[model samples]
Target chain A: MKTAALILSAVLAVAACVFLLAPLVVVVLASFSPTPVFDLPTTGASLRWYGRIANLEGFWPALGLSIEVAAVSTALALVVGTLAAIAAVRGALPYADAFAALLVSPLMMPGLVLGIALLQYFRAVGFDAPLAGLLVAHLIVTLPYVARTMIAGLSRFDFTLIDAALTLGCTWRQAIFKVMVPALAPSFLIAGLFAFLASFDNYPVSIFLTDVRTKTLPIKMLQYIEEAPDPTIAAVSSLILLGTIVLLIIADRAVGLSRMAGTSD
Target chain B: MPVTSLSRRTLLKASAALAGTVAMPSIVRAAPKEIVIGGPAGAAKYFNESVFPLLKQKLGVTVLYEGTNSLTNLQKMQADKAAPKFSVVIMDDPVMIRAAAEGLIVPMQASAIPNLGKLVPGAVHLDGMWANYQLPWAGIAYNTKSGAPTSWADMWAPSHKGKVIVPSIQNTEGFWNLLIAAHLETGKPLAEAQYDIDAGFRKLKSLVPSLLNVYTNAPQAMNLLEQGEADMIGGQFSAYTLTRKMDGAPVDLAIPKEGGFAMPSGIAKITGGPASDLADAVIDAFLGPDVQQVLATKAVVTPTNLTTPRPAGYPDPATLFAPDWGFVAKERGKWAERWTTELL
Candidate 1:
């Protein structure tokens, strides 16, 4: 019975991996099609779709905006969320749990609901700035990831290390920088990675917020698909997949994949 | 190369170049020769590739194009009412009517656009507020293997049960379903017919059992037909349906005996834009014979410009049943709500 259960579990795990990764594999293969359609090439593979990605209308500006928004939001969320997590874990404030929940509430809310609310709120306040609005919206999106990860990390953290460092003649600020930060480095990397990715690929929230000139990559890609259902989008998706793989590989080297996933010590 | 070794001529040249740079801004700022326009992404490709160059040659101005949907354009214009970001907006006729009422767009003199005289009758949507550039008809799309539907009401026929798809009322294509349903229930001409909300609802609900799927957009509906998941898709247009057929899909579009709805798209000038003249010129170019032909051939839409010859494989624009735009613009939202709440 035990052996049978193990076999069943292994099969289910393999099936799940295949189900998730099959679409990505198809996309990468479709990107090499000589034709403009989304179907894969039957005759031979071609790189014309990759070449077309460079010339796709408004692609560069959209990519640049997406990167800028994600980088800025991730950096801001890392700093603010880490401080809030520290407060939630250490400060012993009244209703600390509620405060933590409030900070992470945006994650629980549907992106569409958040988008509509933000648009109305922005309109009521008479704020028409697209770039600034996108930054604020993405910060809301990414903050929950950072806060949740850091909160969990801090809970398991031994605060006595900072105390010990202080007693060993480190200044209060020095003790935090020298002791707490290094100890939480893995958590920070994990939090930053998740936050950056969440912000980078955000669509539903960005849709309501994006104006014509300030379109993000996902919106632009959708527009491209609407305009022409072609392999260029597949090519772009393959590139994005490649980039993510490289990023994960780097993260694995630095922090270990198991640690980043919170699956192992 | 030292600062002390700088020649008099070089210093004079540097001073001259700096002066030109300072004066260039004022010269360029006095009469800005560029206009910003917004439209759908696919349609924008046509204007960018075909129309903009001609405008630059003839009108001596550049066009900055933004790809967007009609609803988003209206919302943006309303939000930026104080200072309009888009100089010209291109969208559907119903949206044009709503925008006209909201004062997002301005009425124009026929004299401003010579090509306006060449348009088919009733192509002027809201008098001078906007004009229809394309008159695409919405109807039923069926896979040939499933057999052609003879009438629009045949979508609900017992034979097609569980083999039909319908679009959600929120989509532009879906509006046709409501208009067609009203026509199906009432024998009166579409213009004389009311939305007949109750009767229309009854007719649509009766057909719900036949629906294999409900789609929010034309692409989703067509995808079902292509994949053989559904046999027929209502609230789709011949332009897209025919285009797919050309791409070797087994689908074909039919204007039912009751006739299909005319889903005309229009272009308007932003009311308070700084570049209204350029916008007018662009509109004129869009309505011109050459541009209209290119749009018809490339976009698969029927041109409103009467002088532009029909492209191959296009249906007759005269056969389409056009409803009252004003009524549609006013009641579509309520109908869409009812559609979602009362029906699926």
Candidate 2:
């Protein structure tokens, strides 16, 4: 009976992995298809679709904007979210639970609602700057991921470690930079990854904010599909998937994936 | 370890510089000679690839193309009505009527756009608020392998059961399909049948059994037909299917004996736009003979310019039907509700 249960569990795990990863596998294979239409490369593979990606209208600028917005928003969210999390967890402020909920409330709201509301609010405040508006909007999008992860990480932390560092002749700032930060390194990496991805792929919110010249990668991909339904978008998707995998591998090397996933200490 | 730290520091500095550059106001502000236009992605792609360079060479005016759907472009114009960013806007006929009603677009003068007189009859709005650039007719698109449909009534045939795709009422193609169904059921002319909403809904309900699915996206529906997953797609556009056919897809659009409806792609000058003359020049360029030829051959759209020759093997413009878009704009919401509750 015990052996049967183990086999069932292993089968279910494999099934779940296949279910999650099947679409990605199909997309990657479709990217190399010889035909223009989206299909698996059963007959043969070609690099023609990948070659077309660079020449796609407004592609390069869109890619540059997406990376810049994602990197900046993720970095800002980490600092602001970490400080907000610390205040909620350790500062013993009034309505601490309420504050944390409010901090993550944007996640509960639908992206469309948030986008329309932000667009209207920005208009009312006379904020005409497009890039700044997009950055602010992305900051709203990414903050929840960082805050939720950091809050959870900080809750599990022991405050005595900071005290012990200070006792060993370290300054108050040094205690945080050396001891606390290094201890929560896994959570930081995980949070940053999630935050960057959330900002990078955001569409509903970014759609309202993007102007003629300022568009993100996801918006550009959708436009390409609209202009012509072909395998070129599949090539772009494959490259993005490969980029994400590389990021994951680097994170794994720096801090074990098991720890980042919170399956182990 | 030192190398790693140096690289990390450099990365931080680079990011900070990027953020600063994005936030900073431009120190060198030149007198702008650009006109911004809003349209669908496909149209924008065509203009950017084939038309914008010519505009720059001839008039020395740069074109900034904003690509999105018709409704989003309308919304953007509405939001920026006080000081509209788009000098010209391209949208479907129904949405252009709405834009006219909302005063988002202004009428064009014949003196300003010399090519306005060169368009086919009924191509320009009666109020001269907008003009059609390209004509995409709605008809039955089918996989050649599954054989061809000859008339609108052929959609109800037994042989095609569960092998047809119809557009959802949200799409403009859906409006065309509903009108066609009404015409067949009521035995009225296409224009009068558009008002017979009950007849349209009743006929469309009977078609539900023959339908594989209702599609909101046109390209995805065309893909299904191209892959032979579905035998026929109702209310598919001529330009879209023809483009796919040229790419070697086994798809062909048939203007049945009952006649197909014209879904004209229209352009208008935005009210309160900064560059009014530039907008007029751009509109003139779009309607000119050379641009019309490019649109017909490369974009696979039927041109509105009277002088431009139609692409080989395309049906005569006289065979296509044109609906009263003003009525469509008014009754679309009511029709959409009935369409959803009954047909869907």
lDDT of 2 at A184: 92
lDDT by residue for model 2 (A193-264), tens: 989999999999998898776789998888888776778899999999999999999999988788777788
Evaluating just chain A, the predictions reach TM-scores of: 0.98, 0.95
For candidate 2, the lDDT comes to: 0.85
Q: Could you tell me which 10 consecutive residues in candidate 2 chain B have the lowest summed lDDT? A: B22-31
- By DockQ, the best candidate is 2
* TM-score of each prediction: 0.79, 0.90
Q: Number of clashes in model 2?
A: 0
Complex DockQ, candidate 2 = 0.28
Best by lDDT: 2
Candidate 1 on B190-304: residue-level lDDT in tens?
Answer: 7655557677787788888899988754555665686567889987875567666655666888877877777778888899887777788888988888778767776668998
lDDT of each: 0.80, 0.85
Off by over 4 Å in 1: A18-51, A83-105, A120-126, A150-184, A228-232, B1-83, B144-159, B169-172, B175-206, B243-252, B255-261, B330-334, B341-343
